[model samples]
Target chain A: MEIFGIPAQALYGQLALGLVNGAFYALLSLGLAIIFGLLNLINFAHGAQYMLGAYVAWMLLSYLGIGFWGALVVAPLVVAVLGMALERGLLRYLRDVDQIYGLLLTFGVALILEGLVAQSYGWSGMPYANPLPGSVDLGFMRMPMYRLVAIAISLVVCLAVWIAIERTKLGAYLRAASEDADMVQAFGVNIPRLIMLTYGFGVGLAGLAGVVAAPVYQVSPAMGSNLIIVVFAVVVIGGMGSIAGSVIAGFGLGLIEGLTKVFYPAASTTVIFFIMILILIFRPSGLFGSTR
Target chain B: MTADTAMLSVRDLHAWYGESHVLHGMTLHVGRGEVVTLLGRNGAGKSTTMRAIMGLMKKRSGSITYEERETITLPPHRIARMGIAYCPEHRGIFSRLDVQENLELPPVIGADPLTLDRVQAMFPRLVERRHSPGTKLSGGEQQMLAIARILRTGARFLLLDEPTEGLAPIIVKQLGEIIASLRTIGFTILLVEQNFRFASGFADRHYVVEHGRVVDEIAAGDLAAGSERIRAYLGV
Candidate 1:
């Protein structure tokens, strides 16, 4: 059997790779979408928070001799707490200011975090031991067991978060706050507290993604910066503030990128931007985003 | 304030948006099961007064009492949980959410949750368009959905700003009927309206506001005798 002028085995291999990449993309963009939706702020610091997750994990394992499994739980929580602190202390002050000020403040935070990590560890990447630590043999091809674990974990986390926001009673208030904060508050839901929780949750998602990606990619300060641009491209393709759109766009773009690498490796880098341009011309609100 | 008589009471309430003062030392009381209207021309601080009562606007200075308890410093959601719902001048409906979804929002946090059937019974149009997104509804339908959404929150006190604004005449008549029904159900309303005609039908008494202060107070039955006061303040 042949697919896209490639052998079936090769196609399947790339599909697996695509799925893994897509999982991370979906996770990162989901947090971005949530923060943007609820707070109406483009969190430029999201990628930094993601890196902080990796750093925390690395620190836990290296200095304290903790393992990957422990860091997975600890790192994201720590990052989320840090996010809450930032929201309560700094972001809260910018609430009445123009929304652009939020963007600027987060961007500054991103730079500071990136700079701190670089100063501490230098530009070299750190190695993290794979928690699952094995390979699984597929009939068509042999694959790393950890890759599948990462994929499964990311998918589960993504679905859990999506369900939490879309299906629960708390989600109702969240949706209302995103749409009309003042009205939601008037109804007696604490808008400020909602804002803080949303920020923390979004940051927590980024941290989780980082912990999962530490094994696949090099753990370094530059890790989040590299992914940040592509994630922004994914967000634009998905549409601003659309939860389902961000998730679908993240995975879809990753699959497209993987296919491009196999068929036309040179075009792989620019394919997401090409899709963004097409989306802007056709459905600017994104595949699932409402025009409003 | 009578025990269990007042739903929301504001005394010497002052609010500001940045450097501009919107409500200046305003005092108003909304009795339980009463429909009260604040009648004024545009920019009379009617909306600000409602927001202050709900604590939506930050940096508020003054006293707000709800259920005979001070609520001046409480957050908006806490105010909402206390059974006060605000429908803004723009009709703060979640446009992306469907009609049922919009109604589903309020009861999620409200003290006493009203069911879909209950709110739909109050505003039938909302039930008919329950599957439709809020933006798809007509102005009247959206208005009905907005009011129903608040009612679903079990809000004993309703702050509705210009519910009939920009609506068709037929819809305005429908709104009047709905307001009448709500009043019958023992709902206390704080209605902000520029159209005296629409307001006079439901409000027992009206407060005339001018340039951020209450300039005149008149009973709805005596609006004819108070026409000169209305003309001077409302310029209508």
Candidate 2:
């Protein structure tokens, strides 16, 4: 079996890996997009939050004897509370200030969080037990059941969030809040509470992605930084604050990277960045992004 | 009038935008169910006063009593939840929301919310464009929508900023009729407007704002007597 003059098994395996990577990318970037849209703050601390999710999940399993399934729910909740606290205590003060100040603040928070984790656990990563340990052979390729589950679940979650945001009244509020938050506040809806909850919800998506990643990758302090860099590239390609754009670009870019690995192995790592550059040069607002 | 009798009263309200101070000492009162107009030119701080009253202006010191309760310390949402709804000067219709969604966007704060049919009865164009994006409507329609949405919230006090600022003459006439109708139904409106002509048609009283302070107050009955002063202040 051959795909584009490449061995079918090898190509399918790469595509499966790409799908798994895309799942995480979509979730992470979607969170970033949501936070940026409403708050107008680029949350640089997102990677640290994602890492915290993995770390918290791992810690729960190790210390509290909580299993993967239990950690799945608990971990995101923990991250959300922490995110809410951060927004109330610090980010609230920077509302009227320049955007650079917000970036600096979140960036500083990221460094502090990442530093604390690195100190507690070595720069190297810890491992989590794969709850679904076996691979499922689907004729063409032997796919890890965990990866399959992760991909399937991420697709559903992303779809649900996109639909809710585009259709529901709460989602309408979220979108309008980003445009004219003061008006939303004037309507007697608490803007500060909404913003805090939104930040918590956005970062909690990262936490969700982290929980999904724990079995596939090592529980690492440095894990999120590497992945987030690629996710940022995905966001740039997708368009800022565009939910559907992020999900589609995440999967699309991941496949392109995987395809590059098969066709031209050398460019696999830089493929997404290259596409980001092209998108920036041509459609700067991104594929699905509105300029406003 | 005593503070107890007034629906809204602002005393010595001072607000600063960064270093440059905007509202110096904005003071005025609106009795319940009265359609009061704030007439001022650009940079006269009409919007700032509205923001200050709404508690949306962060850096401010003022005594704003609504329903005899001091609202100076309350935030925008809290003030809103208290049944004081603000419709911004830009006609804050959400581009992402359809006409119907925009109509339903404001959270209902009062016990008696207006039915969709009631709102549509006032602005029939809105019901026709209910499925279209709010921003897709004309400027007059957008203003009508902004004013329309707040009615659904069941807010007793409505702060409408320049509802006819850029609307056509017929639309402006229609908005005056709408304001007249709202007052007939017992809404206490504090309208911000530059068009003294449109406002004069329905407003029970007008407060002349200049350099962030209420320089003159005239009842609609005395509008004829105060016309010269108003024209000079308005620079019309």
**Considering every candidate listed, which one attains the maximal DockQ?**
2
Which candidate gets the maximum lDDT versus the true structure?
2
Candidate 2: C-alpha RMSD to true structure equals 1.5
Can you write out model 2's per-residue Cα lDDT over A159-250, one digit (the tens) per residue? 99898898998898898998899989889887888899999999999998899899999988888888989999999899998889999999
Q: Tell me the lDDT of model 2 at B26.
A: 89
Off by over 4 Å in 2: B1-4
Docking class of 2: high
lDDT of 2: 0.90
In candidate 1, residue A9 scores what lDDT? 78
**Candidate 2 global TM-score:** 0.97
Model 2 per-residue lDDT tens digits across residues B1-236: 45568999999999998898999898898998999999988999999998889888889997999887888888888999889988889888899889998999888999898887898898889888999998999898898898889998888999988888878999888888889989999999999999999999999899999999999998999978988889999888
Model 1 TM-score relative to the real fold: 0.90
Against the true structure, what is each candidate's TM-score? 0.90, 0.97
Give a tens-digit lDDT track for model 1, residues B1-236: 24246677777888899889888888777788888889888888998898888787786887888888899988887877777788888888877577788877775454566676887787777777888877799888888888888877667778899999999999999899889888998888999988888888878878888777777788777878976787777887
